[model samples]
Structures are given as C-alpha cells and as structure tokens.
Target: MSKNSTLILEVKNLAKKFGDYVAVDGISFDIKESEILGFLGPNGAGKSTTINCILGLIKPEVGTIRIFGKDLFKKRSEIMQEVNYCSAESNLPWSLTVNECLRAYSALYAVKNASTKIDELLERFEIAEFKNKRMRNLSFGQRARASLCKALLNDPKLLLLDEPMASMDPDVVDRGIKLLLKIQKETGMSVLYTSHNMWEIEQVASKVVFVNHGKVMAQGTALELTRQEVQLEAKEPDLREVFIQLSRKAPEMEEK
Candidate 1:
C-alpha cells in the first residue's frame, strides 16, 4: 500500500498475443508486499490475459514476471509454495465435498496438520454446516467461500483472486472482506484482486490499475484517480466516474 513498501510482484513489459490479436500490450505494474491491488477493466479489456500471464497459466510473447524479486518461470516450484490463486469460474470436482476439496488442495500445497487447518477455515468461513456437501450441490456463495478457504490453506505470501465475493449475500460479503483485510494486516500477504465491482474494489484495494484495450489506462489509489477531476470541478468524484472516463477512451483520446 505504501509507496515505500517492498515490491513482491513485478510484471514488466508483459504482452500476450492470441494469433493476430494482441490480448495484452506491454503492460507493466508492481504489487507491494501487504498491498491490495485492484485490477479492474471492462469485459474483453485484457484483464484476463494479463492475469493468466501472472499466474503462469499462459506465457506471454514479451516481458518477465518476477515474484519475491526472483524470476517466476525459473523459480516456479519454489515460489508457488508462497502463492495461491482462486476464482469463481474455476470449479472443484463435483464429487468432492467441501471438506474433500480442502483436503485435496492442502495436500497439493503439502500443508502439515491439514485436517486441523481445514477445520479452522470451515469455521472461519461459516461454512462448517456444509463441510460435507458436494461441490456440485453447494450454492454459489457457498462455493465462493470454499474457494477462499482453499486459497488460505498454505498461508501464502501472495493471493490472487478473481471475483472473490461473486454471488455472495451482503452479510457474507462483509465478513469475507473483513477477513481479507485482516489477513493482509496480520500476515503481510500481497493480494491481486480482480473485480468488476468498482465499489468493492475501492473498499478493499490500497491502489488500483485500470486497463483498456490491451493497455494500462491508469494506476493509482482511488483518490489519486479522481484527483484531477476533483481539483477542476471543486467536488469529490468517486472511482466509478474515473473508471468510466478512462475505460471508454481511444488511445488518441487518452493522449488529449
């Protein structure tokens, strides 16, 4: 969050191309230790492609990804022990119960005392009642919580989430947000949070990056994004206003 904080992740000159289409165009950013970085963009705005590159799910034609100041591709085995990813779109096996899913992931991360950790997460997420429920049968909110629980199993140094509170009720959303903030404060874990919800992003992220048409439109805190407008109009502007203004522009328009 602080400009002086240690950089935990760096994406330098990252570019991903899908045949002739350039999905990501030489984007670069840094996530500081214990910082919550909100990655926001319109649909088809290259957010997914950039995230895929960061997670090592896809290789970019250009640029390097460094985690903990080490090359991610070269040190993947060692670095991944401290990194975990979660998304509402990725599903666990339908046959696996909530407990089973947690158990499976814990084993993957080689967590010790996994059963005890799973119990603690189940209670923390308030999903203990559904711990034995199959993934296929769980409601969207239930599955979302389960995914988050799994991400925490390793006590990772970095957590990557896409639409983390998707389909959650108000109460659950509040609790989940609180828990994320608590984890950031206590463990000093860095977070890369992608969400379509600007309000949610403002509530959680210390800084945000907005991408449009395969390039970075803006990167700064909510206040900084709206600062110019507020200064010009002598009124406060919310992040959504700035987001829309930036995301809808042509590159030439941006120059002007």
Candidate 2:
C-alpha cells in the first residue's frame, strides 16, 4: 500500500495461540482514515487479544499487522509515535495529580509542545478543576475523562479505545461521543473501538465488525446489518438484536 493511501491500519491473517488454544484465529480487517470501526463481540471473544496484537502488546504467532503500510512488529516504535490506546480499566499513578500524569505521559510519548497540548485537552475535557487532584481522588467518570485526555495528548492518527465510556454518566457519554466525532472530523483520525453498549456503536460507528469464536462473523454498516436481520422475526432489528441473533443460539421453546 502507498504511504499516502487512506488505509491506516491493516490486519491480515492475524492469529495468536497460547499452548494449543487459539485466541484469535486468522482475522483480517482494515481501518481507513476518519472512520470509526466498532469492534463488537461477546465476552472472551478475542476482541482484546486482537487489539493487543494490533498494538504490538502481544505477538501473534501467525500473520501480519501493517500500519501505514509499515510492518507492525518491525516498525513498532515508528508506528507507536502516531498511535495511542485507552482502556476503561487502565489507570494513571495514584500519587500523581491529573496535570502531572498528563505531563509524564506526554514526555513518554516524546510529544512536542506537550504543555500546550495538555492544556488544550484539559480545557476540552473540562478537567482543569481536577488538574491538581490526585488520581485516586477522582471519581470513575473523572478518571475516564482524564484517560481520554491522555489518549488525545499525542494528536494520534490512530486511536484504539476499549470501553471508552464505560464509567461515565449518560450525559458524559453523550459528550464523549460528540467529542470523538469532532476529533475525527478535525484530525481525520481512524478509530477502532470496542464497547458492550450497542446503542453507542449505533450512534457513532461508520462500520461495524461483529466477531464470534475468534473470527469476524459479520461486518457492514449498522443499518445494513439491522435490515438484513428482518427475516429473523425481530420486532425491530437494531444492533443489539442483530448482535444477539448472530452471536447466540435461541433456546427451544417448550411445546404447549
């Protein structure tokens, strides 16, 4: 792929095995510029493992992950500079204030103009009031906001998010969704996000990849998936309905 091409991330025949069990079995996908691709799967469905391989946190025993047409493992450092990840459970240092945490992360990423970028993110997330508060002192919602700010500190071209709004209030969740859309619009960033909240995926995802048993079972626009499930007798085939239909087997109804 050409460097100027819109494809930012590519996973081809990516598979990982732990002792004889395959965690992710030969999955392939691509994320394009300015697209929000929802990675949906039930619990323990290899979603996290696939993401780890893409992030180079774990080496897949087979296949390749390419970012900007560069080999992911061989060019990890070069790729990491333009990519970042945030998870709901990932935490900053408890002893550090929010500002301190951001500063440390900025330095780690070798971000230029770190202070200015940190300030912009702080203001955008409206976390300036807690800038001096210790990480342990912040509420779950506040910490989620801080985590998002940290992820955005590098102005990354690719953002990997796992349950990005898991701890927020409904209002904050809405705000965060809006923020993500705005960021994608302004920066043309590509996002690969996983969330159990189907409604949020419906709202923000440009394309949805539904995974099951370590493979992609279905992928398309949310509307297309919903429409395709009309024959399944669902009253209204939304993402949740489509997800349940594809990921589970119906129990046999008892005879009258």
* Top-scoring candidate (TM-score): 1
Local distance difference test values of all predictions, in order: 0.85, 0.86
RMSD of 2: 5.1
Write model 2 residue lDDT over 81-130, tens digit each, in one string.
99998988856888999999999999989989998998889888888899
Residue by residue across 1-256, what tens digits does model 1's lDDT show? Answer: 5555788999999989898888888789999988999998888888878888888889999999999999989988899999988887757788999999999999999999999999998898999999999999999998999999999999999999988887888888888899889877888899999887777887899888888877887888788888852344435437787777776676432331
Clashing pairs in 2: none
Residue 99 of model 1 has an lDDT of 91
TM-score of 2: 0.91
Candidate 2 off by > 4 Å: 1-5, 230-237, 249-256
Off by over 4 Å in 1: 2-4, 229-237, 252-256
